[model samples]
Target: MTADNALPDCVALRIGLAARALPDTTPAELVRVLIAVLGQPLTEAKLNTLKVKDLKTGANGALSEIDDMAALRQALQCLHGEDDTAAQAAVPTPQPDAEGRLPNSIQVACASNSGERLDGHFGSCARFLIYQVSATEARLVAVRPAPATTRLSIDHSAERVKLIDDCDLLCVLSIGGPAAARVVNSGIHPFKRSQPEDVALLLGDLQTMLAGKPPPWLAKRLGRATGERPPQPSEVAS
Candidate 1:
């Protein structure tokens, strides 16, 4: 079979294991939850664009360790429980600090460059995407391309960094440490891993990060709608 046709089975298997382990949740629910956790919307556009390379590259390491159905089931249970505990532990308690306010809106952007010989280090050109997040939801608003000149631009990078710095939450993918460091220095933590599905997972975290509590926004959004507060900084850091 074509590798693409094989991906759904792989994705389903990964998610199903997590589901069987977390009997409280179903494989379908977990996939939906994970799609949100990874900050990916469950939509036809996304699913249509889903690539085997993306799935295998991001999940191959995890998948390789699953030797059999029993092993997979055990691993899923462990992971599901871990997720549950982590969610519960992240519940935010009330506090009085302007610092804890949830963002009203978020914008994300991506950029790539033709210069700087990024291919030498990464064996390809660098692709940069940034997400700006708020309380209700987050959006991918900007993409920065590499500079056209031989040397990189301090001014351009600085500009992009500033935009990301202003965000209450920022998600970055594929940009190297030096570029990521710019945002990290601004107090926004950067997740080094970047895959379409992984991005979806991180997006889920952004919702929880804003909610300041156990059970991320995606769960709450799916479970019910109420006045639950997102978790606090300490809760998020843990």
Candidate 2:
């Protein structure tokens, strides 16, 4: 986008959002850096060619303001159209009961990067996907966005844990010992998966376990007596 001519509304919107996503980057500054990298009108083609390294270039290290890689990636996503807008549309809505709770269900938080997938690592994911799961049903109750923070920091890990403090379980591709300890101390059990998978499938497995014979540790949460896999909380749809 040139200085004399105003940007198109669509382009302006995206650029404004992108600027905000990067820490300390103003629309003017982002435009300046972008112009330096891509030159002239900032079309999608030009934006696509822009790389993370390019963001760090410019006079006096102008783009050096972006120190947080997570936020930097987030800003790039805005220009790349990989942020929340498209994903949020596809995210499932909460299906809590009249009392605003999923009866006989436990809240599970999945570390997510893009959409409704358990693809992100603890303390680094873009968001925590909160799901309310019962024996026969699993519904998306909330999608909590994680604060942009430097990875592996004790302080930021606590902040992330607080985001899903209400959840019973936390699922992720991986979690570090310290972060996992924080999660456990917060009364949220951490479950690690070796690879990325649909959040639904993970909840589905939990649902099946709930529907049948759940493990002793898990059964206790449902208020079931030892050796009794009660499906009392399983309320069928009317």
Candidate with best lDDT: 2
Model 1 clash tally? 36
Q: Return the lDDT, model 2, position 70.
A: 79
**Range of the 10 consecutive residues with the lowest summed lDDT in candidate 1:** 116-125
- TM per candidate comes to 0.31, 0.56
Query: What lDDT would each prediction earn against the true structure?
Result: 0.37, 0.69
How far does residue 142 in candidate 1 sit from its true spot (Å)?
A: 4.5
* Tens digits of per-residue lDDT for model 1, 1-238: 2212222443443443343332123333334433533444333334334332332233323233323455344434433333233212121122333444334533333222122111111111233444545556645544443221111112334555565454433433244455555655654444433333334456666566656654442333222222345422222221
Query: Residue 56 of candidate 1: its Cα lDDT?
Result: 24
Task: Give the alpha carbon lDDT tens digit for every residue of 96-163 in model 2.
Answer: 55666667887789987666788777755667888878887777877787765311122667788889
lDDT of 2: 0.69
